[model samples]
Target: MNVDFWNEKFTQTPGLYGEEPNRFLKIQLQSLSPGYLLLPGEGEGRNALFAASKGWKVLALDQSPIAKKHTLEKARKNGLDIEYQVCDIEKFIHEGTKFDVIALIYFHLPSSIRAQIHARFEAMIKENGLLIIEGFGKNQLKFSSGGPKNTEMLYAIKEIKSDFPGITWEYEFEGNDILNEGIGHSGEADLVRLVGRKLSDYLIKISN
Candidate 1:
């Protein structure tokens, strides 16, 4: 909910993380058919535009209005359409709409609400839908690659898995990688990547 910070950040650069979609997201979608995809904390529309290009109905959200402006500008140039909104991600997570895919790429949240938000995102996905994520991992503080400097915001595989017990993890890895997305992401980084499927409607509801 740090709107002012991220809004100022978007102004400082035309492309903070570059216009390219996350490589992990690109790879994961290749094997699946395009469907309704929701991207939260979507910073400049890179992933949204990419998904829309491939014929997926994309809804992108971020707290910064500037981010939406930049994304829409790029989408226009590329002849892509993405529904973008400027609002708190937590608020949007509780909406009634269901999606066929949900992706979170470097979208770090405070520890206080991380589990609840993650669980809500899980609830929003359709049965048999996919959830893919790529983010800075627990060991990222040792690396120079870009991520929230706050340790609590960094993801841990065990914690993330615990957040979504209903998920059938198709792929999971915590490793080091060389990031080259843009000026914001460069050099070696510790990352956690996962691709999971919500295979059925009979999941045990998350606790309050």
Candidate 2:
């Protein structure tokens, strides 16, 4: 999607994905210690703000300027400060920066570029860092709640395993579930959820 497309989406809805953090993401993040965290494709800053409030330094990236604006506004309202950037994932430069946790919730991209982006994120994670993901499954096309219409843009267990190789999967599953994330995502949905942890030294390194 282009900047204008997402900009319009964010502007059209007061809170497209709602003001609350994703339930799966919130529960997983709460189990870990506060540290540097990253949220990609974060619209309106719900998850970012939630992480910030929990004493985690959050850095959120999205292609929409409208998203950045709304996200910052919410952060300020909650007396929290977050680093939000408006840029395409294809052009984002990691600059050797690393994070303790990286969360991907409802973030989807074309199969043509998804693997590369996932690999890039994997490399940016510190040793033993966590990677939490929850997104639409191929079956989600049957539902209108949310997610990309293209099945190729959706996820499958094998695809995710291929994208983030070497990580120890603490949880991995593909199935259907109910979703109520603002007006954007609602009703029954097919989804893929994963929780993995990078290994430390003395452990076999997993390369994407």
Candidate 3:
């Protein structure tokens, strides 16, 4: 979707997506230590603000300027300061940066862009860093809660495994159910969730 599309969506309903972290994200990140957390496609700042409340330094990025404004306002209202940027993910550079934890929650782009983004993500993580992703599955087309209509935009376990070959898969699963992430992500939805870690030197050396 383009900036105008999202701007119109946010304008139609000031908080169309609501102000709360994704359920899956909250659950998976709770046990991890606080550190630099990156939230790509972080619409409306719910997840970023939530992480901020937990003392995590967050960098939220999105393409919509309107989204950037609203997210900042939301963070301010919660007495939190979250670093937000308005940039197209395709053009954003991820060089000389490493994150302890990176999150890709409900960010769907075309396969071509997705492949490139995944590669950058792999390079951006420090050894043993975590990657948490939750998105619509290929089967989501059959369900109607929310997500890209294109099957190619959705994710699968095998696809993720192939994309991040050096990462040790910690968790992977799919299910259909109501997602109570405020309001937007609700009702019966087909989703895929994964938590993985970059392989450490010990494991890499062993493999060799």
TM-score of each: 0.95, 0.95, 0.92
What TM-score number comes out for model 3? Answer: 0.92
Q: Rank the candidates by TM-score, best first.
A: 2, 1, 3
Expressed as tens digits, the lDDT of each residue in 1-208 for candidate 1 is 4998888989998698988899999998877898999999998998999899999999998999999999999999989989998888667744666899999999999999999999888888899999999999988999887999998999999999899877899899999999988888989999999999985766455422
- Which residue ranges in model 3 land beyond 4 Å of their true spot? 201-208
> What alpha-carbon RMSD in Å does predicted model 1 have with respect to the real structure?
1.9
Candidate 2 C-alpha lDDT tens digits along 1-208: 7888888898888798888999999999888899999999998899999999999999999998889999898888889989999888989887755889999998899999999999888888888999999999999989989999888889998988778875789998799999999989998999999999987634544331
Off by over 4 Å in 2: 201-208
The 10 consecutive residues of candidate 3 with the worst lDDT sum are: 177-186
176 in model 1: Cα distance from truth in Å? 0.2
Summarize candidate 3's per-residue lDDT along 19-126 as a digit string, tens digits: 777888998779988998999999888899889999998989999888889989877887998989899887877665588998999988898777778877777788
User: What are the runs in model 1 whose C-alpha is more than 4 Å off?
Assistant: 93-96, 203-208
